[model samples]
Target: MRAISTSGSGLVDVDVPEPQLRPHDLLVQVEAVSVNPVDVKIAASAGDERRILGFDAAGTVVRAGPEVTGFTVGDEVYYSGDVTRQGADAELHAVDARIAGHKPGNLSMAEAAAVPLTTITAWESLFTHFGADAGTTGTLLVVGAPGGVGSMLVQLAKQLTSLRVIGTASRPETRERVLALGGDATVDHRSLAASVKDVAPDGVDFLFSPFSEGNIETYAEIVKPFGHVVAIDDHHVDVFPLKSKSIAWHWELMFTHAIYQTPDMASQGRLLDETARLLDEGRLRTTLGTEIADFSAAGLRRAHELVADGKAVGKVVVTR
Candidate 1:
């Protein structure tokens, strides 16, 4: 099988053996994949043993494990594969069926590929970590709201909950994109505290920080007393400041269920299934901002570069 693997901070084409499937796995023929910040990080940290670096994939099931019940051969699916194992950068890939979902019929393969990882991250951040539901009513301030996860987060919060959604974006174009994705308002992230306070005078009830490194103080100030903060980035942030206001701090990682083989691992599949239905119903939409024409080493590298530059408005996808 042909694939792209990380090689000394870059990607290179390689011919590797086809992936072996486990008892609950699905053998998928790769159709499209999306690039995320994690892909860039893993590529830069590549060791002596080269590793394939893709997670968001939309593909067709060629074979399903005997234990699989949710899907079968010829099923089109989308998923973010487990980071503990090989990824979906190859022509054919193996993924656990419990973590995969049926692709939204209205979406193209590239568009479907752009949704899984970001959707999972945003969904878990809002519902799983923050414990929000349709009846939940409060203000949600989303930091970095024009990125892949943020784009989906704003939409889901607006569509599923009664919360007022406010997103942060520095540039005019990005702020417009956030508003287009259903954010009630947009604030400049450059002057975050003041901007957020201008729109949410009483302070927000919840804060979602995709970039949490240096904004702890701002978060403490903007979030109201007894408010909640959910972060997804891996920065060493001290949350003690939030303790004074009884603010609860939580972390969300989409890979947790698959990495630990959690009891509710299949819940991710169900979440994605619901996301697909929303997409098909036109309540939600794909965030595919850029699409590479083909799944070549060069195209993958370009996609990685776009994501690493940190300026792309939404998700960047590469189609096979």
Candidate 2:
């Protein structure tokens, strides 16, 4: 099997043995894979032990484990594979079927690959961590609109809830994309606090920041009393500033469910299934911002470079 691997120095093409299917795993013939910040981060942190450098993938099942009842051979699936296991940079990957979702019927393999990781992050952040309620009317400011997770968050908030969605994007294209994707309005991230205040004088009811590094205090200031803030990036923010507002802080990491093998690990699959239905119904759309033609080591490295540079507008996918 051919795969992209992270050596101590950098990415390289390598030949590796095919992974054996576990009792609950699916041996997927990978069709496409998407790059994420985690892939870049992991690449930088790679040790002497080589590691496959992908997470998001869309593929067709060629083999299914004995205990896998939900899907069969030939099922088209998409998932963010467990970080503890080999990833989907290879032509074949063995993924636990419990965490894989059926690929969106309305999308191509590359488009579906662009969704899983980002969708999972946005879904869990809004519904599980920040507690967005469909019946409730509120205001939400997505700190990095039109990015992979931000794109999904904006759409989900618009489609599933009554919240007035405000998105922040530095570039005009990204701002416009946010509005087109369902943001009630777009705000310049340069002056996020002022821009958010202009939208909601009382402050936003919730703040979701996919890249909240130095703007923690700004988010704290712009959020309403007892409001919630959720972030996916690592940032050193003093919680004391939030003390006066009685705000809640939540950090969302999409890999935690698979990393720990939690009892609700299968919930990721359920989330994907629901997202697939939404996609087929035209309620959600793919976030494929860029596509790499090659699925080789060079292609993977280029995708990682774009993500690591932090200017990518949406998910970057490379097809096999």
Per-model CA lDDT versus the true structure: 0.92, 0.90
- List model 1 lDDT by residue over 1-320, tens digit each: 99999886578899999998899999999999999999988888886569998999999999988888889899999999999999999999999999999999999999999999999999999998889999999899998888888899999999999999999888889888988889999998889889988998999999999889988988889999999999999999999889889999998999999999999999999999999999999999999989998798899999998988988877899998
* lDDT accuracy of residue 223 in candidate 2: 88
TM-score of candidate 2 on Cα atoms, chains taken together: 0.97
- Model 2: number of clashes? 0
Q: Which stretches of candidate 2 lie above 4 Å from their native place? A: none
TM-score, per-candidate, Cα-based: 0.98, 0.97
Shift in Å, residue 264, candidate 2: 1.3
Q: Pick the candidate with the highest TM-score.
A: 1
Residue 208 lDDT, candidate 1, scale 0-100: 93
Best by lDDT: 1
**Candidate 2, pairs of clashing residues:** none
- Residue 34 of model 2 has an lDDT of 97
